[model samples]
Target chain A: MTNNILYSIKDLSKSFSQSNKKVTALRNVTLDINRGDFISIQGPTGGGKSTLLQMLGGLEKPTSGMISLDQDDLEKLGEAKLTNVRAKKVGFIFQNYNLIPTLTALENVQIALVPLGIKKLESERRALAALESVALSDRANHFPSELSGGQQQRVAIARALVKNPEVILADEPTGNLDEETRDQIIDLLVNLNKESGITIMLVTHDSNVAKRANKNLHISNGVVTTRS
Target chain B: MFFTYLRREISKRKRQTLLVSVALGTSIGLIIVVNAASAGIGDAQKTVLSGLYGIGTDISVTKSIQPTQGGRGFNFGPENADSSGASTLNQTRLTVPIFSGTFDGQTLKQIKSTKGVSRIAATLKLNQIIFKGSIAGTASNPTTPQDPNARPRGFGGGNFNIDMTSIEGVDTSLTNVGPLSGVNIDKGRIFQASDANSQNVLADSTYALAQKIDVGSTVSVGSGTFTVVGIVSSASSSPETSANLYIPLAQAQTLSSNPDLVTNIYVAADSSSNTDSVQKAIEALLPDSTVSSQADLAKNLSGSLSSASSLVNALSKWLSIFVLLVAFLIAILFTSSGVTRRIREFGTLKAIGWKTNRIVRQIMGESLVTSFFGAIIGLAIGVVGIFVVNTIAPTLSASVVSPGRFGGAAPGGPGGPGVPGFQPPAGGFTGRGTGFGRAAENATTLKLHIGMNVSTLILGVLIAILGGLIAGAYGSWKASRLSPAVALRSVA
Candidate 1:
């Protein structure tokens, strides 16, 4: 039923002008994502996989189309409302980990709770819990530069999951890691989706990472196709 | 969270923080120093004006007159000759200076009642000339021509010498409002109320020193001897006084044969704000008299002190503004560049659901913290600068010319005199004019002492805060306009 659908897309399209030429990144794509679904979008470089992931996170707007997360329409909402949706309902992870170099691991996790206006002690307690979930509790006081790539990614994951959002969108979350570290990060995300019933949409080039998700979509040159 | 973030961010970039604070601190310090120096220069100018105008006397009124023809003369007759056909004549004449005109005593009463006049004092300025010499007895010399201009046959064989002294008659009861107000008693005592009608005088220290006179000594004026009650020095440390000798107003009027009249009136206004109005009122009251206020008097000043005043007012003022502008510009540029270097960081913040306003606030907080440190450094620098200025105490010299036209006097001598029983000397002699037509010049030297006030400190802090706000606004605007999507895409 429609009540179980977490995201509904209709005729979504995006384009950008590069060197005075319009290049289509996403075009007339329609899809539905049910609650608690783990979906992976695999595509080559310059494809629409990351664009779709960003749209789902409300980080980018569609040139023409309508997309809704629950009852709120991402296209119709103002910038402030979109920001609020991102704060309350969505979390994002980048390929570079993107942890603030000036802040420690615990502070990076606590930063997510800042927009929620939680009390300082409670934010700290919850941030420590999130670090424990990622097995990064011992490194809470370590800065990003002091942490290994896999450890920093885990801290990034702790930051994303600390807010208890409805969904997490990751753009190449494990692209910078080696074979063993990439598997660890992917296994952590899988456990978060399975144990917490939180929906996830990830864009990756690794077929193995895509194979772990329950649903997989492939795209190239702005067109999407289902992979059974 | 904001404070923690700001603290970490500033601590991380210690070099940039120090650079901005030092630049702004230099500007604010310069502003304080310039302002204090200007105050010092203003006091110096007031000192020069007060040399003649006197302190606490806000307005002055005077009138100028041409000297009388054939300037006052001294002659001898048969009665002035001795039995040896030799005569010694010694006489002292007290008269108003050739350039001053006296106003009626009734005008003083009217000025005292003027709307803004808080106090009034009148002075009669006079010049005393002493003529002491011998004249050949001409009673038996009938061969001498009766024509006063005729050249005689034989010389009189006598020498004459003349001396001039400036004298002022002041109201002993109200010496606090006129020229006497600017004098400090160096010896003896000031005039008491009982000395108002007596033949007592206050001699200038410089004049008394040069004349080898002291307190309790008697000085002759108009053939009358007056005891010197006190010896006074110029309050501004000037070389001369407004007058050499100060006597009671009554005695001066009587001696000068100008009874119940005053040549100059010194006025005190109720307040400094009322000075212009009082001057206008007095000007209207006596249309023919010249009324001058302190502001008007400052413009009439010249010499090195005036140049210093101009340098402080024009050059230092502009220099302060220019340095402040440059400092502010440097702050803005540094803030903008710091923000530019952190574009990806801000984009990551926004992507993590940090609102635009929150990020803007973080940037602004960092700038304000830096600016606070700048204000502290500026205050320290300003205090040091003021201390140095006061310690050095540079001296400046100022000169002001009298505000009236000089009157010329005609030369008088025995050559043109035809007194009975007096014969013209051979190779007739002539008395030269006193050459008093030149404008009166007053010069004073004073050491400058720069002082700091509470308001100047407040201004320095306010300036630092303003610079922070300006720089923060520009930086925050740049931070706020960042599109998170585009920013992340470029970095990726």
Candidate 2:
């Protein structure tokens, strides 16, 4: 682990019980993610790409070995501390644009700041700024149902970037969009990464998305391999 | 932000919100209506009792007349023949009520000394009978020798008329606790201290109106002509007063030939709670007499009022409770289901770093807002129910068997005039048949008026909140159990 490394992973493994059988999603995986790294993971469905991204986001716990973010062991932290790590250090974007249906696009973005204990007015201001960065400020008050797929995905990206987390974990962020909308979303995410220096770990099945990342990794049957 | 989110969420799911609110609201409304009806029945009971025992009377003591006690006797004789040889007779007798037996004034003293007795008044309840007719000249022939075994020819020959009036001997000095306390003077004045031993009389409004009697008119009773000094009516809604005529106790005792004796003793306790003890004490002193507290007297109340009281106390109360419990269960189930449906939403929030407590808070906030709206709807429904009850104004009739009147022995023998040749005068007395000593049992009718009080309204609100809390708690518990990984997996 170097001084520039934001995440240090060592021989981590994760398994799930499926119909009383142990199915491993990640096995003896070793990885290092440095600050400002744009890492893309590519694999088939159920091949541990989303599992690895969830682990890096602190949304899942590894069954063995150790993983750390900024010197704090993810496996050793209590529930409250783990939640705090997730709240202020990591953000997530789902493939389906998981914005709350009841709230406007701006409020969906502001929700990320809720767990950080920010005041409502300050949260709204920062949310607006995040939406502007994503070029979705014009649709800030539009509900998720009222927005196009690209616009909704942009709102989801704004929500992830609003907290200024050190890393954003996006699982197939453009998986559900058409080519034009997918290109627009990918451009927005790339711009956020280039300007803000935010680390991004994206899991995608599309080789085009993987080619844009600074580092590309492939996994199959719970095994990881870096692409040249 | 919290409130805005809550509002949006509630508005988005209108059907679910309405379901919970209407269930809870109907339950709360039923509770309010039932409680109000119970209060109204209580007031009606007070009115009925006031008609029977007067306003402040808490305990009443009386003795039932025995079969061997006595019977009414009338005597008519001829000093000679009036011109055509017919005997003219006119007689009026004031006697104690067939159901009541007199006790000396010493009993009143004993009751006054009883523990918790605050005020005591004694009264003599009497019945005045008037007979007016003349025997035929041929019916009572003095010169003719009558065979001892011969059947009389004039057995159905008399042209006599009879009338009976209910009267009360009131202790004017203690009107605060007796039957007189329940009357209002319609004309003239009530008795004064100086009128205690005087020959003044008060006529009940109904009786006076029927007889065309007014203030300063004269009415005959017990061989004496009394000037009607006042016209009085019952203070309650009952059409009939406690008695047809009110007379001074001294004059009643002298005229009825039962000196220093009273048939009924009315006692007012120091407080309502002490009435039982006072009744017990009086019962101990007068073991053979009937001593009744207000509650015991209420048992004697029959008719629509009593039925309403029973329905309000038993049926309505239980129904309200049953409906409230069902409402709470429905609310809890609905809220839990709503949370279950939003599992993916909650999982996403948890992944975004929202604490379990915050998610729980949001669920509870939604449930509570629904319940608050439910409370408002319930209040409106309850007010409407109360208004309907008042507008209907159902008249409930209540009859209390005057003490010693029920299941008692007949006072007199077979009905017949004292004269030899006067049969039962066509059809006994004018007003009533002399059947088995049945005393006049009067009924009081009152209009029921439901009322709303502050405490009941507060209770309705509190009940709605409680229902909300219970449902919210269950929903929150379910939401808290959803681990983000598992919740998201289920939705995925």
Candidate 3:
């Protein structure tokens, strides 16, 4: 994989107003992630890890500082263009595995390709391939309810991968899974990153999970410290 | 792609969507049905009233006399003559004859030539005794014989027997008084100008039949027995109480015991003629008698039917508003609940890069499809309901249901032969086969002059689409505003 910087964040800060009081979530933090790098963000609860990820994913704008992806400043893009960028370039995996309960595992993956205006048959084929990549091909027809917690999270990961985006942002990918299932999910994500050379930024508090990344980012008191 | 999203969204919230659609369809359908029925009945009533009373007659007049002056009161007799023996004695006495002076033929000619007199007709009213019992006397009364020529006394004073009359008149063009004088001959014939000097007379069918008299049979009126040349139906002048015996003016005068007096006079004018001028001319010609046109007479006879029709329209409008409100509330509730239940699914779509606008379009499309189906179902229900109501409740005519004529046929009773019926061919609640049937039938030949217009259909469709759009837009906006992080957190 190329050793080119894909995301560069500098002096990023964010604060929210709650009950007429200002509560800072993230304070001056700087980071750089290269293409194909798998980085894990580790911090205690309320450590601003999720807030930092949201800002980098363009899901929320930083209160201050600059976030650039592939030399394109995200702050400069209009709302519509920002949304378009997120749709085309970023894939998100939530902690809850947010697989739409009404859809099957394959359909959850198929949804990612819909925004690309792919034909139904091709989209389904791509979704099937994504499910197969996660080793859930046999369970493609099962709905989220029919799958275990680990299986649902795997389906969510497949949905994220089907988009072929430039960055994969996962917020506590195995936060709700048992240790055994969590280990399995981490292994699958690590192998995916190694094989596809896809850049992954994951938020996790587990040391074992963090150890799987090529680089570790620690956030404390709104400051991010990168340790190789 | 958007439609696929819509299908998914609907499937996700099937119950909520269905509830909203059903509520909207029912409300809108109810409004449509009520409005259609009210409009239909209003038009029918207008046609019936117009047919019964010509156009633009603002007033009506009848003989008014002081009850204490011993003057003859206005005749308010039943539509059919007395069929029982005790009713004739109760008939109000006519002490002041309709006409008391000598019958002057020169005066009739003079009245004919007067200006402002569009058309004039002279009428006579009298009571003639008729034999109603069987020709053969009952076993208890051997004195009476079974013979057509047998003369019986005191028959006119009995309830089962009474004096019937033949009113005669020439075809005079009176200003706006055509309905009062325009006798619709349903079966046989009408009095002609040629019959003026002849002995032929046209009697009311109901009266003739009740009196056991047939056409071509000779019946005595005054001093003469005239052959029943024709049978005329009753005019719609008084729906409940009008039994007219029509004959030529001259024949009527000759048959009356008092030949010089005429019962009443009616004047009809051309559409362009001023009613006031005709009234003035008649007043000047006959200073001692009353002079009034059809308009003046109608005002005194019955209240305006238009006011009643307006009341019905107002009621229908209120009903429509109520239905619309109900539909709006239902849509709001169902859409809100639907959006709430689908939060997590929406977040997933958002994560997969679905724009808010695309999501909105999908919701709207689903709502529109559901609303369209519901509207169709509601329309079907309304049409069938109206047909069933109309069929079962024959008393509720296509015309305004007047409180006074609740149990009987309407005045003018389904427009006589050659006259159109009250229900117009084009107006009424039309849907399913009803509207199309009417269109197909009316295409070949014109029957009822009124019909359904494009505005009705357009209005219904527009309201339905508007409902769908509103529901869909509301659902979409709600879903779009959801926080993907919070939604994902909530998903178990």
Q: What is the lDDT of residue B323 in candidate 1?
A: 84
Better of 2 and 3 by lDDT: 2
Native-to-model Cα distance after best TM-score fit, residue B480 in candidate 1, in Å: 2.4
- List model 1 lDDT by residue over B1-492, tens digit each: 887789888998899999999989999888888888888888887777776878889999998765465455565554566776665788777888655788888899898999989999898988787768876644455223355565544544566776667788999998677888877889999888899999999998877887889988999878679999899877785856677889999999988889999998999999999998899999999998989887888887787788888888985679888988998998999999998888888888888889999999998899988888889889999999999988988888887776752322322223213233334343222222331222266777888888887898899989998898899999999999999887888789
Ranked candidates, highest TM-score first? 1, 2, 3
Q: Report model 2's TM-score to 2 decimal places.
A: 0.83
Weakest 10 consecutive residues of candidate 2 chain A by summed lDDT = A50-59
Comparing 1 and 3 on lDDT, the stronger one = 1
lDDT of each: 0.84, 0.83, 0.61
Say which candidate scores most in lDDT.
1
In CAPRI terms, model 1 is classed as: medium
Cα lDDT tens digits, model 2, B252-362, are 998999999998899999999998889899999989899987788788779999999988889677988899999999999999999898888898889989998998899
For all the candidates, what are their Cα RMSDs to the real structure?
4.8, 4.8, 14.1
TM-score for each predicted model, relative to the true structure: 0.87, 0.83, 0.65
Residue B405 of candidate 2: its Cα lDDT?
A: 48
Off by over 4 Å in 3: A1-3, B32-51, B54-185, B189-203, B210-315, B387-391, B394-464, B482-492
lDDT of 3 at B118: 56
Error of 3 at B149 (Å): 50
Ranking by lDDT: 1, 2, 3
lDDT of 3 by residue, A61-134 (tens): 78899998877788777667767777888888888887877678998888888778899999999999999999
